[model samples]
Target chain A: MSEIVVTHVPHKRSIPFGQEAVGALSIIALGAIGYFLYPDDLAFLTRLIGIAFLVLSLDLVTGYCGVATLGHAAQFGVGAYAAGIACVRGITDPVALLAVGVFAGTIMGLISGALITRFRGLPQLVLSIAVGQLVAALANKLSWLTGGSDGLSGITPGKVFGIFNFDMYSRTAFLFSLGVLVIVFVLLQRFVRSPFGLMCRGIKDDDLRARMIGVSIYPRLVVMYGVAGAVAGIGGALTAISTGVVGLDSVSFERSAEVLVMLVLGGAGHLWGALAGTVIFMIFEHIVAAANPFHWMTLVGLLLILIVVFAPRGLIEPVLSLASRFKRKGEAA
Target chain B: MTNLLEARGVSCSFGGLHVTRDVNFKLTAGDRVALIGPNGAGKTTLVNLITGDIAPSEGQFFMGGDEITGLSIPDRVRRGLVRTFQTTRLFANLTVADNVALAIMQRKRITRRFFSSSTELPEVRAEWSEILSHLGLAKLAYRKVVELAYGQQRLIELAIGLALHPKVLLLDEPAAGVPHDEAPKILEAINRLPSDIAVLMIEHDMDLVFKFARRVLVLAAGRLIFEGSPDEVTADHEVRRAYLGSYADARRAT
Candidate 1:
């Protein structure tokens, strides 16, 4: 499976020489630099990494597959809750929590994807919101197990390979989360370039034409949705493991909406946009909230409006186009 | 002999209005057939029923004598019954080559590989070249569908269906928007299709219909009015009254 090859498509690239490799390096560099630069705020940065994972997952279905969802946080919450429950049940391995979280997310994704992929437009949005709310309601009503409104506490995870412990500063957690993000992002880059990923883009572009050429739309979409769920689940598990807590707010509607906003801000289809949007939004939230908690949300709302008005294709497209234009000119010269 | 693709007593209605009425049709292996009718003549509706885009309220479909009455559009395509739309249906944002590549990938059923791009596949490359060169679309291969002119897009549309390797192809107005000068590339592409594969083109252009189709079927207001060789069809008085009036007038006027 390891061979040196080139990819023609821009949305997907796995080679170590191109933008994919550069992006991978950047994420690692960010995590390392952030850990050193903001040792005190490592926890916040790690959480942003986790949120970035969730937005990456959303980008799979919403950006590439053209699915409209505002309830992706349901997958994240389920993953977090699953990881949290595993920890509560005496499975404290960091690796174990991540696995359980991913499994739970994938299963939730498959089921919800089946439901969500069945409808379009208004019904789709309703189904997404309905599913998220239902999960939130279930989590709230089942207080005896989930710790309900109080949130799940005592989610103590054992250290990395029994060496690194998740300390007060969360340095280990940041590295672990960064490691996971790198791995997942690499895998995603490979996937969106794959023939299957191309088909998903094809379906997103013109489902009827996709069908005209013998693509079974529903099943493929279902699988895509499920995969998205798995990614979000990983995000959830990271959140639970790093913080050692799982809250009802993890699966709340606002969580889903926030990720959507993050995806839009950075650009939805491109994986790197997930990182850009998440980092920008989280830093903005921290800065504004610290300055004035009430006005921070208003600032965020205005920022989203500005982005929609000026850079409708999201922040990445313009930058990428400009970079490519310069490169083309350089090549010509 | 078993027909390659058959539609028997097929009928469909939208709410209370009948769109297609008891349309019985057949295509043997390698026959060149055409379907022509006035606007709203239920030509496309019949094609949809055959392709299983929508199910017929009455009657059945057969592909090589096997029951495919309830099959979905993609499944019908998988069975080698492929079609192009009346209006172009293409991946507007994707390159023309990728558009053709997507169809070839779907046809090869190798669209699920997670590590490699489909364009890198030898099979995909081979098919992509053949289809593009055949339609004279090689120059426009790298250009996105949205950037191409309407005529170029129509040619690309035919190239996509051709990439599917249809056992029986139903082309809906393949030359509808194409100018006369550029229409031959489309005709050449159709002419270059394998002799064993059957073709049924739906066209309003009698010149194209006569030039490409050895046999023709005329539909009017959702009924099969005439089915015969091209010369016989053009000479028939009934066809003249219902559909050929304009074409015949244009010819006489010229």
Candidate 2:
């Protein structure tokens, strides 16, 4: 009786050990794998990491906040192009390139967010797609700066703190991108559990009730859009730095739609799902397309249909729920 | 400041039809005023006007004597003008405690804090415990709003409104789907609110309204038909015909 334990009223564990440990272990494992097994394909894997970041960004707005969008690649494109431009303009420091990416993504996110969040449902989806296409078109037409369809090249990001130079083997790029992913994941984990995050969830659940409870949904969503943009920007800039080129493909409508598919395939609401979905989709695409380019898309489409019909909450959520159910049952016993 | 909430010449119309017209109303602190009207009498429209869910076509609304004519719903709520829904709009996916704690967090101005645990905080827990207990919902705190019985959901709605620390609470059907025996608990919870906070309840249940309201204002055809003590409301011929009718005789017999 003296050793009786009283948990908190809301039953939220003080230390989010499971999520935090998962975040840490997942990234550390990714780093270890990239260091060992994927040494030859580091460049392709690094590029995939950038796409994962975009998916995570999309998840923040689409999955967590319930903002309907398909043009997230617009923000990603701006980030990549901004970093490429910085490299061309001689702001060669990798850190500065990352900052430029963040800045570019944030600006686009705010501009599009204000317009899109004012509408609901179908209008939002259309507006977001329109924004993505507009950016992509601009990138193609601005030949002098963006280098037309050939993409902006000669982008050489300097060392990590001027010590470890980006090499041909692609070791530094992988580490830098992994480090950024870990920091962003940890921050986002804190965010989704925070009061603001809960309010965002509240807004997603019922915007009317959220308004009745004194939540100004528009501004909250706009800020979320900006944060998501900044994270996605990191991905874009990392892509430019690693690949040494920036293509209009970064902001293409195809990129926008495909990232959404990735989010849905991996799971959207959770940050880890972004990584899981990206790795799975890219690896699957690489293998399948290498064998048959045209037919590979059909398989991907089939996989998406299955996920939509079966794992409607996204792929990982079903697993998480199952684990929790088992835990609940164990407690009862 | 004597009148915590007031409506002056408030009228609203849609297209060519007038839903509510030029109704002046006021509520003082600690007052329990019930707004009663039959279907299509603009009971909901008038409440929406007061809560800023819709703009009154004419006249103004005031909170503590300050004209809040064109404020948004959230802005009105931040000034301590909170309201519960007719259909019970708790966050269906969240726990009952989360629903109530969110309002408290908004009141505390810590709704933006990213790293802090709202549930783990001692003060938040204490507040949830008190409010949940007051509404007989302490045991159901962990239950999701979607999983609760309809009656329990209704009580959770009231608990959330109370958690906002409202100077004036507008309860829209506090027992719409509640069981007959559970209604007393709803009325009892209303009786237990802090005396400083005024309440304007919109209920169709004559017995519950008659028991809870110190004063009752009746609306019919979008007009203020009667405003008096419960006894006067029970005796008024116009209220009896337009809104109450046979229910007045039943209330009077009690």
Candidate 3:
């Protein structure tokens, strides 16, 4: 008993760091693979990074905090529009554009989160969808600013840090997105393991208990939504910067639904799970759509069913279990 | 001295069914009061009212002379008014240590620190380590709450309530579902609680109530019927009638 206690006590402080190191390494390795394997299709990979940020943001609220939201794309879209508008208005520095996206996403997250977090379960989900549709409608109505259905275009962001021009081939754009993904991933790894993140998980599991433990559920949730929005904003800004266009599709309900699918596909709560799900789902979609553009949705639906049936916790659970099992065996040897 | 917790004419009703009627009680520092009554006697309802789970339709609650009728549940808790549920409500997926650490974090107001790691915080680690060890739960600290036995989970619940540093701790059946053999350990832990903090336990377990509580409060039909020492409680006509064949007859047999 004493031995077990001794061994476990110190393990907590050290274990997550090892997991983080692996997460960072895998992200870098995957980014390199995308760069080398599909040099001509860097734009697609950049788009994946943008969506990855949205999914990660969703995981913070929906996965960790257990808030049901189907309108997360509102944050992503708001970020995209914010960046695009800033660029068209002469604030085209890529880094500055990303900050603008973050700010926009945070504000949108707080507003929508405040309204949505007031309820629970079904009402929350409905409120999220409503908020998403409302944003989409507003964007469509404000045609002069948002370009309505045509999307806000003619965005040509300046070179990153006065170097590494975003060329027509999208090489610089891909690297920039990947770089942002890595930085965000690292920071978020720390963020989620922090005390705030742990409290959110507690609230997610049992909010009544959290309230009893002296947690102001609404305010914490609103703040978390703000954080999640900021991350989603980064994703949106990346999309605007890399693609040089802000489309109505960016904030569409369909986009929100698809990103949610990606999040659940990889897994929800784990940060790495969010990244893995995005990569797998997006890559799978790209391949399937290319193979059969007319019936691609059917294929995606089938894949979702299979995944839900088999890996209900998402694909990351089994992989993580196997990894832990292997580590125990290694230690025994 | 001002009472640690005081409920003055506290009443609650769900539409027409009054659950707690004109309920009044006082608990000062180092109180070991047992609230026992038949099922649906408004015992849990009273606990809920005090913990701010359900607001009293009438009357006010005071903590150290401050009226707290409109305070939120968390606000009441922040003022050192904590509770343990009849059925254990823990973070089932979290490790036992994390479960306790969360309350500690809430108390220390470090739950908002997003950049630093929770596990590596030396202050928190020291606090929870001492708490778990003191409760004889050191071995199980790393285990998830779901993995623990029901009795152990109840102890974790107590651990969490303690972590809140409560002045008035309301425990609703801390040993309701524990195995007969393991119930004593929970009682021992409860008995070992800090001497200064007042504890009011609502329990149907006669033996536990008799052993742990110096004073007993009996309720029937949502109203306080009697309040006195354990010996006086067993002899009181209303208390004996409230327990009927169970507690009163058991005392007679013993």
Candidate 1: which stretches are off by over 4 Å?
A1-19, A330-333, B249-254
What TM-score should be assigned to candidate 1? 0.95
Model 3 clashing residue pairs (backbone): none
Candidate 2 structure quality by residue, lDDT tens digits, A126-147: 9998888888899999989998
* Inter-residue clash pairs, candidate 1: none
Give DockQ: model 3: 0.59
Among these predictions, the greatest DockQ belongs to 3
Q: Please estimate how well model 1 matches the true structure, expressed as its whole-model Cα lDDT.
A: 0.88
Ranking according to DockQ, highest score first:
3, 1, 2
Model 2, CA-based lDDT:
0.87
Tens digits of per-residue lDDT, candidate 1, A143-235, equal 988999999999999988899988998889999999999988888888887899989998999998999999999999999988899999999
Models ranked on lDDT: 3, 1, 2
Pitting candidate 1 against candidate 3, the one with the higher TM-score is: 3
lDDT of 1 by residue, B1-254 (tens): 66998888988998999988888889998899999998999999888888888888999999988999988888889999999998999999888888999998888879878778566576787778766765667666767799899989998888888888899999999999888899987887788788988999999888889789989999998989999998788778899899998776666577
Error of 3 at B25 (Å): 1.2
Clashing pairs in 2: B240-B245
Q: Which stretches of candidate 3 lie over 4 Å from their true place?
A: A1-17, A328-333, B244-246
Scored against the true structure, residue B38 in model 2 reaches a CA lDDT of 93
Candidate 1 docking DockQ: 0.51
TM-score of each: 0.95, 0.95, 0.97
**Which has the better lDDT: candidate 1, or candidate 3?**
3
